[model samples]
Each structure stands twice: as structure tokens, then as C-alpha cells.
Target: MDYIANYVDAIVIGGGHAGCEAALSLARLGKKTVIFCLNIEAIAKMPCNPNIGGTSKGHLVKEIDALGGEMGKNIDKTYIQSKMLNTSKGPAVHSLRAQADKVEYHKAMLKVLDAETNLTIKQQEVSDILIENARVMGVRTITGAIYYAKAVVVCTGTYLKSKIFIGEFAENAGPDGLKSSQVLSNSLLDNGITLRRFKTGTPARVDKRTIDFTAMEAQLGDSKVVPFSFSNSAASIKKNQIQCFLTYTNEQTHQIIRDNLDRSPLYGGKIEGVGPRYCPSIEDKVVRFADKSRHQIFIEPEGVETNEMYVQGMSSSLPEEVQIQMLRSVRGLENVEVIRGGYAIEYDCINPTSLLHSLENKVISGLFFAGQINGSSGYEEAAAQGLVAGINAALKIDAKEPLIIDRAEGYIGVLIDDLVIKGTNEPYRMLTSRAEYRLLLRQDNADIRLMTKGHDIGLVPDDIYAKFLDKQEVIEAEIERIKKVFVGTTATVQSILMAKGSTPLTSGMSLHELLKRPELDYKDFAAVNLDGPELSDEIIEQIEITLKYEGYIKRQLIQVDQFKKLEKKLIPENLKYEDIKSLRIEARQKLLEIKPKSIGAASRISGVSPADISVMLVYMEQLKRTERANDASVS
Candidate 1:
């Protein structure tokens, strides 16, 4: 009997956020893409929170939207609530978050997938990758069906050898009892890929009707909702939003957790994966912060159509009985029934050092990896990587140039660079603090920062590109207008300044100079016939920040210039680090194993210090001068 198998330009393993983004981007770019999943119904499933975007994470969603990805747009369509966080802080930290109707989100994304011309969604577990002579040829599913592909993306997320833990009990399953890809672990190992175990946990889901809203502070979404996509239809996103309640876990809640600590998989040492320190489970919280009397617990509605609510900040793998006890002890959750138990999931991912800046494997040419499979923990982080990997994969097949993002541009760039360079020991999560040039790289300007790249890669549409250009023009005009406006110490201006606690101007000063004062802004001098062009709040914000932090921003830009110098000093693909004189033994060994792309990357790797970078920089410089001298003589 002759058997037939399907062929595609790209095979994306896993239908999670990372896989979905990778598959969609590839298809939209005209590649024949197939997305392999454990369950078709679980496409774009939110295994944990029934929400999207927060702080730095929101920046990612907007950037994805700017790049023509579907997450922000889909989330906007299905969101039950929306809010802008860090309002009291600077615009750089203001993040948009939305509580979504989970079912609707999944359904909406699936419809997009179904409508995509070149993408096929298949319900199958990818068990093995077919790599020959260091280039990916195809993938083999668990059912033994071999799908031929020119390039393959392994976005297995936390599904490879997944283990879910509740208390001391552990079961081999993905987040929602889905089958683990055990065979894939062996396959990755067989290919000489280095592996690491990492863990992430989700809190219990509660019956929404049981929570007492009166006992908690009502958290409301922003009134003027800003959609994630630059192409978003302005057909009013405002609606009656769901309110999340905040309650505190008292001494009793902590005591219950402390008493039952040994029963937790994390505390019991039953789970081996290195979990993220920032998003630790409830059991970890109690153990690490014994002195804290209470912790904030947020009760968030899962969806408008369902009565389920999420118990935030109470994530634990404690015994079921103890979980019920501790949850009930919380302020507003007195009679909360345990609809689902909180648990931690451990899974296998490759040490990202094994991957290149392009998210493609150096050893396996056409094979790429992204998301949790690369040890990054957030949905935003995963999706961002997926876009990069998918783009590079298509470029690989097209024999076009690969895309690489340095740390200065966007958080996505910072994320990939950190993952490949630092080689995280624990599950990597993106934090705004991780970005070196945070002052310039902010959530507010993600579209401004990366939309051009998206356009260049054919991800962003021309209409969106035009809008970005308009936005840039408006910001520049407003800044110029403000710089030209002048104000004097007239009674009107002096009185207004006095009222606002600003020092009286000594003769006359430019309106821009007054704006640079800590107390006054351009908006405050509205009476003086504003000098700069009239601008919207958004554009005004850009003007103010640019004027105020111009010097600091310039300094960081200089640092970026110096950094790129090292980043450009590429390590020869087959350079023998061992042959480099005065290089430390550990440096030589690590350099050989990791095979970093440049001196900057090499400097970040463990055992390679500033001294090692200097040595490498000098060697590369000498080689460069020699090559130039040789070229001059030839000419």
C-alpha cells in the first residue's frame, strides 16, 4: 500500500500563541504553512490568565499589532475590560491591559486562521524533527505521518515532556491535561541540542458568583480605550467593562500556606524545572517572605459569558485540601469553591545559547525555535520570538536576508538579545528594567520604534505605514512649535506660574524652557498663545519627553553607537577560540560551545568578561586592518 503525506513550505509545531503568530506571519507573507496542535479547539488558548497585556507585556502586544500580527486586534475584539496601567507614572510605563472573553478570543483567532489563504491548522502532535546535514527537512508526528517542509519551527512551548504538579502529585500532561510530547524531547536530545527544565504556574479558577465585590477595591479599565493595532477601526471600543476586585491575604492565609509548605511540589523538591522568580507560586511567596503579613489577591472575571473568575497572586501547587483552606481564608473568598486547583507546570526547552540571533539553530540551518521552547515565559515574549523566527524561516526559504534586532530599538529586540546572550538559567520573562535604553525604548513608542521594520518585512500594510508617518510628523511639528513659543514675567504669566508653585521668571524665557522646568509643562501655558503647533495629548507627550530628556537620550544613543561596534565585530564561523593566545580555558570552551555571533554577544556569555571582550576586539581589529591593507595593495 502506498501512503501519501502532506507537504508545506513551513511546518509550525504547536498552536499556542508562539505557534499561532509564527504560522500566521508565514502565511501572510505567502508561505504555505501548517500549524500542528494537540487540540484544534485549543488554538490561541490562554492557559492561565483570561487577559492580555500588562506593563512591559502591553508594549509587546501593541508592537505585534503595529507589525500586523493578530494578538492585539483579536484581544480588542474579545476583551471584556480594558485599562491603562501606571497612569500616575511616566508615559513610558503606561501599559494597556484587557480582560478577554477566553472562548471568544480563541474562536476569533481560529476564524482568522481558517480564513488565512496559505495556512493549514492540523490537530497532531509533532514528535520528531527531520534534520539532515544540519538543515531541517521536515517533521514527523506522533502518529508517524511525515510532513515535508522546506523549513520547520519548533514552538512546542511547555508541551515537550510536560509535567503538571498539584501538591506532591505530578502527572505528565500539558497545562490542561493534554498529551506531552515525550518523543520530541528524545529527538531534540538526539540532535545534540542542550536542554533545560523550566516551570510556570497558574492560580485556581473561582465561580464568579461566589466572590463578594463589596469587600474588595474595584479595579476599572481606562475610559478612552486605545486599541493595540495601528490599523484598528476607531468604531468605539468603549463598553461597560468588568471590574476586578482586589483583596488581601491575611496572616491566616500565610499561616495555612506555611503549615502546608511541605505538601507543595515546589517546596517538596518534586519539581525540577527552574521557575521564574518574579512570578513565583503562592507556596514560594510564603517561604520567601515569611515576615510579610499579607499579599494582594486579585479576583478577576474570566469572561462576560462565563461565571468563572481567576484567583490572581494565589498560584500554588499545594495539596488540594490546603488550597481550599487557604483560599477560603482570604478576605472576599470566604466560601469560594475550588472549581479548579492551582498547579505548576514543568517542561523542557533548549538553552537559548544553542540558538542564533535569528532564532535559527546554527547546527540545523532551516530549523527554528521560539516561545517557551526557547525558555521565555510570557505570551507576549513568545509571540515576539515567533514573529522573528517565522520571518527568518521565510527569508531562509526565499534565500533573502535574515532579520536581526539589536537591544536599542524595541523590547522585543532586548528580549531576543538577552535570551541568546545571557542564556537564562530560569524561565526568562520580559521586564522593562531589562532594557538598557529604557528612557528611549518605551511602551508608548513601540509603533514608532519598530513599525518600519514590520513594513520592510512586508508585515505592516502601506496604509498603516502612512499613518505612522503622519504620527511622526505631528510629533515633530508639536515639538518645534513649543520650542519657538516665548513667555515673559508678565502679571498674567507670573500669576499663573505662582499659582502652580513655579519660581517667577526673571525677564523672559522660551515656552520650551518653561516646559523643561520640573513644575510647568507646555499645556500649562495655554494662555500665552502656544508657540508650537496644536497637538493631541499623545503627540504633546512625545514633544515634552523629547525636549526634557534630549540630553539623556543622546547619551544613551552614544552608548548604543559604542555597543554596535562590538556587536559588529563578528566571530568567524569556524574560528578556533583555543588558538587565540591569552584567552582563558573556560572562555575558549564556552566560546566554542555557544558560538556567539559577535564580541558583544561573547562578552555577555558566562566566563567571558570585559577583558576577554577587549582581547577579541583587538584580534578582530588587527584582522580587519590586515584585510584592508591587502585590499589597498591589490588596488
Candidate 2:
């Protein structure tokens, strides 16, 4: 019954967050693309957390929006509650997080997918990826239909041969009981794609009516809302935000988990996949931090239509009876009724070191990988990878150079470079601490940092690009204007400074220099200096940050210059690493396997040492000298 189905310019193998971005980007670039999933209803599903953007994750979301991706816009349209986290900290760590209406988020994204002129959404399980002469040909579905394509992107996020575990019970399924991709792992093995197992867990959902809100602390959303997408302002996306409650796990709850340790699948050796270290289950937390007296738990609504309340910090894999016992032990959940128990899922993912900087496979010419399949753990991480992979796939078909974002450019670059160069033994999560130039890579300036690149790739529209350019010019002009506006020790200026508790100005100082003071901000400067151009809050914020951190920003830019020198020194694809006698055996093995494109990338490899880089530089110079001598003799 096997037959040819259809042919397209590109094929995407999943429909989750990563797959959605991948499909949309390819189609928008004028490529005929088809995205396949086991169930179309699961497209852009948020299986684990109820919200998007937290800490470093918020930066990833804004970066996606800046790159003309859909995640930021979709979240803005559907969020029930939005908050800006870390206001007390520096702007570099300030991130916007929002609790989304899960059902509506999915519907919004699906509508966009359906509306795309060149994109097709198919409900099918991609069982095999057809390869011819080390290049992708197409994919075959479980129903024996072969759909041909010029390029393929494998974004099978946590579904390839997925299995769920709760206590001693196990079932072959994906998140929320969706169908597991059964045979794709075998097809991947057949083609020499290395696969590994990674496990992630979700907490139980209890009925909201059964919980007592009076016993918990009321956690309120921000009074002022912030939009995730650069195109939308706060005024456009404002709504009545919902409220969430916070509770805590006491020693009694910890004791309940400790008593059930023997019955837990995670500790009983029933689950084999490595889980994320950063977002560990309650069981892992209790066992690891035994001395701690309590842990915080947030109760959040799943959606406006659903009564299910997600227990944020209580993810577990114990028996249902133990789960109930632990839930009831918390303050507000004393009489809570569990709608569904939490479970851990183990699924197949690839060794990310197999991918190039563009998310393309080194050995497979037209094959790309992204999201959890690349060993990353968050929705934002997956969507970021998908956007990059989709853009690279289209560029490859158009016979253009690939878009490679390096560590100096943005957080996306740091995420990819960490995964492909160093490789991860556990699921990789993005953190602000991971980026060396985080001060310069703040979430507030993501559009400034990346919109031009997105426009160059043809994803950003001309209208949006023009707006960004105007905003950039306004910010630069204001900064220069502020540098010339001086405030002397007039009675009015001294009174304003005294009211703000700042050091009294003995002599006249430029507004830019005054902004460098820890106490004085742009608003404080405006209060002192009367005549200034009216600028939007967004532009003013950018100018404030630039003047406030000029010295630090300049220092980081110098570091970036030094880093780019090594990056610009390209490595020959066919260089014999073993020929460098000074290199360690382990270094040679790693370099030979990775075939890194630049000395900067090679230096970041885990096994490659500084001494090995010196040897490489010397050997490449010798090769150049020999080539020049031969040319001279021929002349």
C-alpha cells in the first residue's frame, strides 16, 4: 500500500514550539514547506510550565521576536497574567514572564500556520528520513506515504520513542498522552545519527474549586503590563490580569516524599534518562537539599476555561497515593482534589555536538536539528533553535551562505555554541550567567541587537525594519544631545539634588555624567533640565542604559574585538588534526570529530587545550608557506 504522497521544498518533522517556528520561517521565505505531527491539535503546546519567559528565557523570547519569529507575538495575544521579573536587579537581568492561556495560545499559533500561503500542516508520524548520498531526500510517514522534499528538519521534541513513568507504572506515550514516535529512532540509528535519552517531568493539576486561597499568600501580577513582541506596545496588549497564590512545602511534606522514596520510579532505577539538573523534581530537591526546612510552591491556573491548577514546584513521579499525601500537607492544598497526577517522561534526543553552528548536520548535507532534539530543555530554547534551523535550511536551498550567530552577537549564539562545541551530558538550559557579555545582551535591547540580521535574512518586513532604524537614530541623537546639556549649581538644581539625596553639584556637569550617578536616572535628569525633546519611554530607557553603563559596555566591546580575531581565522575543513604532533591525543580526536570551522570554535571544544590551538596555528602557517614556495617555483 506504500505510495508517493507529495513533494515540497522543505519538510519539518514536529509541530511543537520549535517545529512551528521552523515551518513558519521556511514558508515565509517562499519555500514550500510541510510540517508533520502525531496530532495537529498539539501544535505549539506548552506541555510542562504554564507560562513562557523566566530569567534568561525571557531574553530568548524577545530575541525570537526580534528575528521575526512568532513566539513573542503569540504569547502577547494570549497571556492571562504578565509580570516583569527582577526589577530590583540591573536591567541586564530584567525579564518579562507571562502566564498564558494554553488552549488559546495553541489556537492562535495554529491559525497562523493555517494562513501561511506556502505552509501545510499534516497530522502524521514521520517514521523514517530518506537519505541519498549523505543528503536528505524526504520523509516517510507511519501510514506508508512517502513525502519528498529538498531539505528536512528533525525537531522531534521529547516524542521519539517516548515513555511515561509514574511509580511502577509505565506506558509508551508522549506529553499529555499523545502518541509516541515509535520508529523514527530506528531510522535515525540506521543513518548514523547518534541518539540519547533525556527525561523531564511535570507537576500534578488539582481542581481550583477544592483549594483554599485564604491559607496561601496572594501573588499579584504587575500593575503595568509589558509586551513581549517589539511591534506591540504596552497600550496595545493591556488586559485585566489574573491572580496566582503561593504556598510552601513544610518538613511534613518532605517527610512524606522521603517515606515514598522506595516507591518512586526515579529513585527505584526504573527511569534511565538523565533529567535537567536546574529544574529538578521535588524528590530530587528533598534528597539533595535535606537540610532545608521548606520550599516555595506557586499555584497557577492552566487557562480561563479549565479548572485545573498547576502545582509549579511539586513535580514528582511517586504513586498517586503519595502525591495526594504530599499535596494535602501543603497549607492551601489541605483538602485539594487532584485532577491528574504528575509523571516523568523519557524520550530520545540527539547528541547536539553532531550539529554545525547553523544547526545543520555536519555529515548530512540537507538535514537540520533543533529544540529538545538538540539537548536543550525549554520552549524558548527550542523555538530559538527552530528559527535558526529554518532560516539556514531556506538559505541553503537558495545557494547562499548560512547565518551563523556567534557568542559576541546574542544569547542565541551562546546557546548554540555551548551545545555544539562543549556538548551537554544533561538537558541544557539557558541562563544569564552563561553569557560573558550579558551586560551588553540585555533583553531590553534584543531588537536593537538582532533585528537588522533578521531583516537581512528576509524574515523581518520592511516596515518593521524602518521603525527599528528610526528608534535607533532617536536614541543615538538623544544621547549626544544629553552630553551637551549642563546643569550648574543654581538654587533650583541644588534643591532638586538635595531632594533626591544626591551629592550637591559644585560645578556644572553634563546630563550624561549626572546619569552615571547611582541615584540619578533619566527621569531625575529631566526634572532638573527643562528644555528637552519629547521621546518615547522605550527610546529613553535605551538612552539611559547606554549612558549609565558606557564604561562597562566599552570594556566588553574590546573583549568582543579580541574574540572576533580568532573567529575570523577560518580552519580548513580537511585539516589533518593528527598531523599536529604537539597536540594531545584527546585534542586531536575531538578536533577530527568536530571539524570546527574556526579557531575560536575549536578553542571552545571541551577536550581541545590552549597548547593544541598553538600547534594548530603553527601547522596552518607551515601549510601556507609551502603553498607559496611551490607557486614561486612554478612562476
Q: Best-fitting candidate, measured by lDDT? A: 2
- Residue runs of model 1 more than 4 Å from their true location after superposition: 233-235, 530-534, 621-635
Q: Which candidate is the best by TM-score?
A: 2
lDDT of each: 0.85, 0.93
Clashing pairs in 1: 481-532, 482-532
User: What TM-score do all the candidates reach, one by one?
Assistant: 0.95, 0.98
Model 1 poorest ten-residue lDDT run? 229-238
* lDDT for model 2: 0.93
